[model samples]
Target chain A: MSDPVISVAGIGKEYVLGVSMSGNMLREQIASGVRKIFQRVERPNRQQQRFWALKDVSFRVDQGEVVGVIGHNGAGKSTLLKVLSEITEPSTGEIRVRGRIASLLEVGTGFHPELSGRENIYLNGAILGMTRSEISRKFDEIVAFSGVERFLETPVKRFSSGMYVRLAFSVAAHLEPEILVIDEVLAVGDLEFQKRCLGKMGDVARSGRTVLFVSHNMTAIHDLCERSLLLNHGELVADGATGDVINGYLSGLNTDASIKRKVSNDADAWVTDVRLIYEGSESRQGFKMGQSLCVEISYETKKKVEHLGFGISIEDCIQSTRVFASVSSIHGIQLENVEGEGRARVCFPDLKLVPGRYMVTITLNAKSFQYDRLEGVRILDVLGQDELGTGWVLSRQRNGVVWLNHEWLLDGRQ
Target chain B: MSSAETTEMPERIIRPKTGLIGVNFRELWRFRELFFFLSWRDVLIRYKQTALGVLWVILQPLTSVVVFTVIFGKMANLDSHGTPYPLITLAALIPWQMFSNAVGASSLSLISSANLVTKIYFPRLIIPLSSTLGTLVDSLVGILLLFVFIFGYLFGREFGLIEVPVGVGLHWQLVLMPIFFAYALLAAIACGLWFSALNVQYRDVKYVIPFMLRIAMLVSPVGYLSSEIPENYRLLYSINPLVGVIDGFRWSVLGSEFQPYWPGFCLGATVVLFFLVTGVMFFRNTERKFADII
Candidate 1:
């Protein structure tokens, strides 16, 4: 496929945690020499530790391909981009690519606060490898796209956060590099600006340039990329079609039991385990978007309890907005007068959720006081089916966290 | 089956090297318009918030001349070799102020813009070079004030209160003023390259630089005339590069009997060139670590 425009082989990066001292002065050199001489008897303490931020990562992207790198925090996504961009050298292995690269690893990265917005646009463009004539030709288009034409002569330090991101993204997207590497910078601006940025990225991809996008939002990744890579704890866990890799990543998250439980030393109660079942049998770890699902919460209590309520909540991780919550009282299920050890099961006939990752939380409470809560007990993946039609899709777009059934109005003639 | 497909094909993609040593000077030259904009921004911002505005430029060297006249001319009763102390001191102070200001500003240029250095790729040398150029505006203003003072002195004497001496005609060699000023600028640029490179790795260098400049000012023959030194020790005294620059300025402006001090000028020129080359190499070597460390 056209010699793979970008090739990364066995790339790894190591960083030292503490300060490094060398022979910066004559006295320091003599002191270090004396310490080395005395090392025959007693070794001096070295307070440095090494961490591998990225390890043995290898990937290839064909010419004019848009690839998405998806992962949770600390998954080595940024380190991979930094190495590919050559901002820093990899500790081992090698990478080879052809043509010019522009990396938008950060918004407003090289902007001088005292410089005006118009001035910084040219400066940022040059830093991205654009010539003066190229930036000059595109200057008006950038300013107009950013919607900061009225404040063009004002110093960027005075611009609001939204204005800053708009200007920053405008300069970056218009620079016209052969390969573009962007990392979550689009998440900053308002909704309309974000949509514009996505549209611009789509245009750039369609124009035949290679793009490497890193983000936590699965829907954005699925919408933009045909091929995707999933990173898990500095390892390449999966790489393939966007849907398959995303589904595989969601399933892999369900099997991690330790990650579900919140461990606290001073807690009165804590969740120990969580499981999902259906029809009296352990079903596939997750459910379809509108399928019946059962959840079981197992916890330990340090003291006897008289009155307590068990509850479960579903929340969208990206937006951190709670979607649906139910308490034991609402379901007519309560465990009281005996609470030394307990397990509670809650079942929903049809849990309506679009195809995305949702965090399930378990909480135990006595009236207004909450004894304990497992912040994120389990991650659930709900798939979509055709029976719901485009109505369900509209609801999914309106509120990404949950899917609720509702009726639509008709005209008087109908 | 015979219908032609209307699908569009994807464009070609290319990737280039991102190493600091691989900085494309051609690209920097291509972006020269941005450099001029940044340099102009620095010039404007420098004076924008100041109270006295551009008047501070003329006052800086003039006030220093007054202080030097009081301390050396009146208190120490130093000889000006038949020339007025104010005229001689003001000529020397003009170039000295420009040199000091350029070195001080350029040395901290990298650290001052830590936010910009880590995020983007530009020729890091441009920061210091632009800051050095920013000081030229102040030096130009100082030069204008010096011309006014010379005109007044010549006019007042022509009105007959003071006798005008013949054969003390202004020498055409005064055109070398620009050359001497260029030499001083080169010296400042050389020191800037050294300090800015060092400041990136060790922040203590920033604090130590002002102290070093203070000591240099005392020893650089700015307040005292080079003629005060014994003829035998004059050769050793001129080893301080500013001594030759100050002697040249005073000789050009005030028509002093002093010679051009070509030996001192040659030594200063050699030292400046040496620092300039080595400073550039050192700056290039340390530039790779700036993004990581900064």
Candidate 2:
């Protein structure tokens, strides 16, 4: 085997939590300086806390390998990419790479709004590490891909947001680096444009280039990358095949105890536990796409209650969107008065959620007052397939929550 | 998607570089084209929506000449060393405006372009370096205006246009323009590096700059003649960086009528060099903290 195109040893980045972000005010700094002179002594304040944004992350990717980085918020995925791209320095350790690397931590970087779209294409291209000759050679292709050909002469500030994003993404997509580090920039634009971006990414991956992709879209990662790395709380938890890594990530979420809300001392009535049922057994939270799934909620009430209203709210945790609030009131289910301990089970025989992770919030209302509203009571995962075998993978956020069954109706002589 | 394309660029190692003089000149040379684009974009954007466009370059110094002529020449009766007040003040304002505007813009260059600084990695020096360079276009125009005024006075005398004394000789020493321009450019970049770096952290530099430039113009040899200074305090007054720059411009343009105080010029040039060294040190030291705070 040839040498790895990118080699990263145990690199770490530490962000001083308080000192770095805001020692900015000159007056405060001056005051501190003055106080230092008067005190005639120095001391290390215990408040100076060092938060490691990335800790001891090591990985290597051979040429032509597309590796996906999966992690939750603040999991050091972005920090790792920033370190590799040299946008910021790693506090410790070193990285060696054999090729020129360009990172698209954001698209439309350095685009001047007052400049014409044509000018910005050149400006943004240069900023993204594309030489002038390379951009000039591919100028027509970049404009053609953006589909905003007529507005190229106009200033970009006047262009609609859709046109702006398309042009920006188009310029970024044409950058041909030996190693590319991308951070969820593909999550922009509409579905059709995202497809073009993915297509461009695939073309890049096939041409003996290395790609390090960081994104929350598991389906996109699963469809594009052969290998993946999973990060949890600044540590690399797993790295292997895309399927296995995503499976491990999803199951890790489901089994995590912190997902379940703790006991609420203020509420007279509250939920105790939420369990998942798949195929008529108390299985873990992972459920197959387009299959029956059940969420059985158990709760305890201290005193007698009337007309107890219980419902479950499923939120797309990755997307930060609410999928549904299937309350007993909304679904026309009635409840009896005096309650001590009771269980409510809601099941969908054909749950058509787009495959991703979700957090459920139990909303239990007693008459006019809110008894208990437990957020993140349980984390669930929906596993999907490219059922039509068309190689189109669904994105949980880019596409909506519900997956409607339909067939292509493009006409010929039908 | 072919694998045949190649540039043979060298491999780069990424790690924390600790020291005062870690600036890699080769890396900076590799990104020379980007510096051109950044300065080009700045010059292009500056005149974009203005009604006068590049004409504002000539008009701005003309207005300053008129204003300073009224304030210092007509009323205060400051010595012009026998050159016409407008011509003398214009010569001095040329370098002064170049220094002030470039330094002013560069003081805030990193903040205004924070988006690019945070998202992309190039030599961070390019931001302020480009800002200082952006003023070169205006200086070129302002210098052309000085030439027209000089030859206009020379020719206008033959046609007998009503004349004030034609004190400007257009002497052979004018060939030294590039040397004094080096002084102005270095002074601008030195202040640009210092203020732009500090502005990234203590944004008080932003509020302090414009006010400081106003005070700097009054103290520098812009409105009044440097000959007006007493001999005892001449070297002390040369501590201001622009003292040499403004005096050098007048001596270059107005000829022997306005001789630059050589001792003061040497002192001011030393001061500029001093700040430039410390500026680079401060800039390189603080540059790593920018992407984090900014």
Q: How high is the CA lDDT of each candidate model?
A: 0.76, 0.84
lDDT of 1 by residue, A1-414 (tens): 246667887887777654442313434446767977877775434434566888888888877789999876678898788777766667777787765667888987768777789878977776677777889999999999999999998998999989999999999889676678888877789989989998998998888888999987776788889999998778888889998987786666566645445545445666677777766667455677667788887777767776678889887654445778989978666667654566778888877777766878888877667877766557876665564665544235665655668877888888
Clashing pairs in 2: none
Model 2, span B229-264: residue lDDT tens? 899999999889788898887787777777788888
lDDT (10s digit) by residue, model 2, range A193-265: 8888889888988877889999877768988899999998789999999999987876676655433445545
Q: Quote the positional error of residue B107 for candidate 2 in Å.
A: 1.1
DockQ winner among the candidates? 2
User: Which residue pairs come into collision in candidate 1?
Assistant: A98-B14, A98-B15, A99-B14, A99-B15, A99-B16, A208-B11
TM-score of 2: 0.83
In candidate 2 the C-alpha lDDT for residue A401 amounts to 83
Off by over 4 Å in 2: A34-47, A257-357, A360-377, A381-400, A403-414, B1-9, B163-166
The window of 10 residues in a row where model 1 chain B has the poorest summed lDDT is B1-10
